[model samples]
Target: MNAKKHSTLDHALDNYSTADFLLSDHFVNHQLEPTPETALLWETWLAGNPPNRHEWDRAVYLLESIRLGLSHYAGQVISEEAIEALLARIRETNRQYSVPVRSIGRVRWMAAAVVLVLSGLLAYWWHGRHDSESYYAERMAGLQSKYTERVNRSRAVETIVLSDSSVVRLAPGSRISFNPSWDGASRVVYLSGEADFEVTRDIRKPFLVYANEVVTRVLGTQFTVRAFDAEGKVLVNVKSGQVSVSKDDVPEKGNVQDASGLLLLPNQQAVFSRRSEEFSKSIVSEPRVIGVENEMPSFEYDAVPVTRVIGDLEKAYGISILYNREQLKNCELSASLKTETFEEKLRVICTTINADYQKLDGQVVIHGGECR
Candidate 1:
């Protein structure tokens, strides 16, 4: 690819969020439903470099609100024709959906807060291990020698230093099976699930990943591998560097050339089908978004308005937001969610709004008539 294109791709990949991946998945599944107006808004918002946090939160809030509203109003009973018309008017004017609210007591709030904080720390520690190349390389080699032990739910997270210094964070629920006595020119591992890899550069010892019939070769790079057993499809998302992906024959004919793979650059993805023995590549953005750079403000609130707090909850958790009283939007809420459950989080928000939460048909609804 040209330098300009490569640069643009890198920027998009590094700053990718869960929403972008969802959007791509829509296209991949052939379920794209974006209207021209929505597309234009997305383009305009994404064109800006590192968009403002408040505006970014608002955009996510609006999109989710609309999505939820559509789902709710699709099949609901209304009193009179005028009430139906009024509902339509409200929907058109709001252009957003109200997220369902679930109640949580003080105890639940405390427990959830603890989990969230600890999860963040664990994620950070995993990244630190990936930064040390030598550590992970040795660990990787040791694990390869011990492959094929056939242990159920045998989970291990290792940060190995490759021959060169680079880091890779392997997520949980990943397993590898290989020969203990195997020492070939190429370093290889058989993947059964998902794992993130940060490889060190050594033109001599190329890193090879085997997922079912597909093989991914990389000299040095950071990427993720997802081999779904149910669907029998494999995916590789490259964060940096380059990789060559291909398919091979079944184990019965050891090491037979099945089909040639495709070369992928940074911010690109490759998908392979075991049955069809076909691989396709396309551009993909990164997976994480909020709090990525530490430059954006954290989800901290101190007596903040209820509407703004609800907006934050929707962005952080990727869920629907709802409210019955418009006056509650101005109610003040002071709470932290560094650790909390969905129920607890809602209670905190509800407490400030002085409202009650109810669940109706798997959806939460806030029904108090007064606020403040």
Candidate 2:
């Protein structure tokens, strides 16, 4: 809020992804488990800058997709050529996620590498027709508007079940107002403060949350959105599935519906930058597996290639493992561990393999000597 805080934030964001966002430690932390401090930091960043939200969302989806795709090879021995081939496959998959031939006719990517159309462009496109603001706002206007608004002024989280059975855990001091339009056209809610949503999947109707200018849209997923007015920021953290985020601006040119805005995957967070009117993506401060039911392992590797060990670790925790395969390809490890934490697992692995792993700019990065 102060000039100093804004200046510090700008510097951090400016240097944000000085390397690839996917490769950064921020991504790694979010991929693993983000601490409350980390989540708040990102929330502050996103809620401050609104314009950059879309980019953050798309990157989250892409990064998570790539990580999942790579996890399939956990049991296999990865050679240099095999790794290259896998990278090629990743590229191909990315192309698939991108816009294909613009089915809407007027909505085409401005650049080949641009993952999602910016909300500015989308605002322009949607301002003409299919204006979600006018459509939903008009629908909610006058006595004809039928909506339910809930405000939580108490000290405990309020769990509210919507008409469609979608559940929202409204944080204390937060408010959420929604229309029982499930049988109608769109399921939209206006939110303030922070709340976690366990949204029921509805193919026919998409769940949309509007807080200030930031919009978080999803079909069915578990995620948290923080958009407190006093904070001057909007933030979305996806626990499962993908969530779309956009600013409230309706530009005069491009179609808003045509723009993807931000597409967020599990463990990723998007910060809306009000200072610069841009959205930035970061990993949650502490990211845990979406479902706690997944069996956490007591890993034991015997004379296995370092790659295999790392691969198994990645799979076990559902997080990305970045390492210098050239340095570790020939190395082998023999370790028996039980009741160790995720970090402890890595520490033992690294010790046995003569490697060092750490959170590098929010990613798990490892480097070490050859075992041979």
Candidate 3:
């Protein structure tokens, strides 16, 4: 023991309350007996001893060196009950803290009591710290898992980077679910509605996307999928690389033609209609950008009757239109009305036909408004 340890031991003796003595004896025996907070306090005091600072630093260095040298001892297994029983024997011997019984056997008995109490406290503190660390680790793991589990409402457009650094752009009113551990036999994702995927190449594990009863399997492909339950259609358009689309029940080997299956190249589209049980492939010259671009024609005014134009207006603007029986036949006009509101377009049409227009509950009416 050096000067710092000697001074520390002297201080320990001066502060020899039962708790201090018990703690000091345990430390001297190389046993842990302090709570984490208490252990921190002991370390703090050791560092603050200015007179013995050099010796304290050297002692701490040696302790670390000894710990590394004793790494093999970590494999030893000991039970808490055995340690407790030993501590009980020590407590019984020193319970009264009476006079010195000067017999060889009596000395040995006292020494055994000291070792037991010291070792028991050390073991208890070590186990407590270890248990506390493990508990925090488990809690952190649970929180990480919760981060990936989510339910989204509304139209949400999001971009996500996968474990392999691939990017996917999810469309509005779409659902996408993936695991945090996005690795294994296959990198899989569940998709509902629409999304565009730009996959990184990992030939070892193919990327799979599941939508409804359809499964798209590919390796390093760029593609867009528009799957809708209400529309009863799944559109798979590949912009680059190869993709394989097969019905859930389709086997690996059969007389299934390319029409029943599709291996799409760049700028190709595969549409599967559930109602028709049909799969169609086409060389898409100009792919319709789903959700981003409107697919319907802007203006249709060639030989269409007035009734047909009004019907188109109602469906496009989500409104109702009523016209007088005689006005309906006389209201025919050749006009283009895209990018115009229900009332604005109706006003134009009413003016052209010399018919008065009225608005009612998001509806356009032309009077003399008859039953028809």
Candidate 4:
């Protein structure tokens, strides 16, 4: 097959007109998948002082722009047929504008024009296939009437301090909108993308973060909310204090009370699926100590029963660890676990006592055989 392609390329170079090579499969294949043989052949041809060298350069530029435009904007592979169609469109456009296709000075302008045209078409198709407006745009539009918006367009994280002293670290490409003045009822902020929030304590006005389809309500806490518009699920991970995550459409009857939602404590996470509109609770990937550093629990257990060790871990991390007392009563461990992580401590104890642990509904459950 490579030999046949090489033959075809040789024939095109020898007999075909300068611009006619643009339509040859050899040129398209070379542009798409360049091999050493094809590169050498093209270099040799260019070295022969072809009169249409400018046209060749222009063609390469145009083809590269088309490939890049389609890949970046449409996220699709460029087919040979699509390239042919695009070439035809460029010719038609050049003819429509009464410009020569091989104009050296206009090559860059033409390539840019083609890219813009392709970008516009991709945008139109994307909007037609999906929602007319992006999830972020739709949510922002809904709040435009009553809120002030801030967008983080930079590559680095942006810090936004609200009037209530709540600090929001907005991720790049994310945006948030909030009422300029709180009405003493509730402080609400709508988010699109990910953000880490350190909300100030306010018993009177609860802080709420509305992201995508889920609403996260907290009085005063530090947490991270990951709710990108294009993602299939929304995530709320509590770092300190507590938060209630619920569907945005669900009405809250009383103060900070969600009709149906998951209450996430420190080191807990809630994953809300957009398709099913359901939530699944789980422990965060890395659970940290909940309280102040000075009050950190001593994990150095010396000949202590497994139950007492588990109790200390549960209290330190503010997570429940369930195990059968009768089964693990005889299990004893003597290890200095102060340096181990929450999971490492659990693993060390469980492994010593022939037990296995699993996380279910944001809590750790242990399954172990009777210790002799």
Candidate number with greatest TM-score = 4
The TM-scores of all predictions, comma-separated, are: 0.37, 0.55, 0.35, 0.63
Q: Candidate 1, 167: how far from true, in Å?
A: 5.6
lDDT tens digits, residue span 1-372, model 1? 211222112334335433332222221122124554544344333433333334333333333333323333344533346444643543332222111111224433343344334334433433344322322233345452455532225356655433345454444555555443345665665665677888777776667777655677887887888863333357888776678787744432233234466877665678775434568664453322222345433557787777776676555433345675466755776777656655567767766666766532223466673554
Q: Against the correct fold, how does model 3 do in TM-score?
A: 0.35
lDDT of 4 at 22: 42
Encode model 2's per-residue lDDT on 157-219: one tens digit a residue.
999999889999999988777767554556777776799999999877788777756778788
List candidate 3 stretches off by more than 4 Å: 1-156, 250-260, 285-372
Ranking by lDDT: 4, 2, 3, 1
Question: lDDT of each structure?
Answer: 0.50, 0.60, 0.53, 0.72
List candidate 1 stretches off by more than 4 Å. Answer: 1-168, 178-182, 250-258, 287-372
Stretch of 10 with least lDDT, candidate 4: 1-10
Which sections of candidate 4 miss by over 4 Å? 1-132, 144-146, 250-258
Error of 4 at 10 (Å): 46
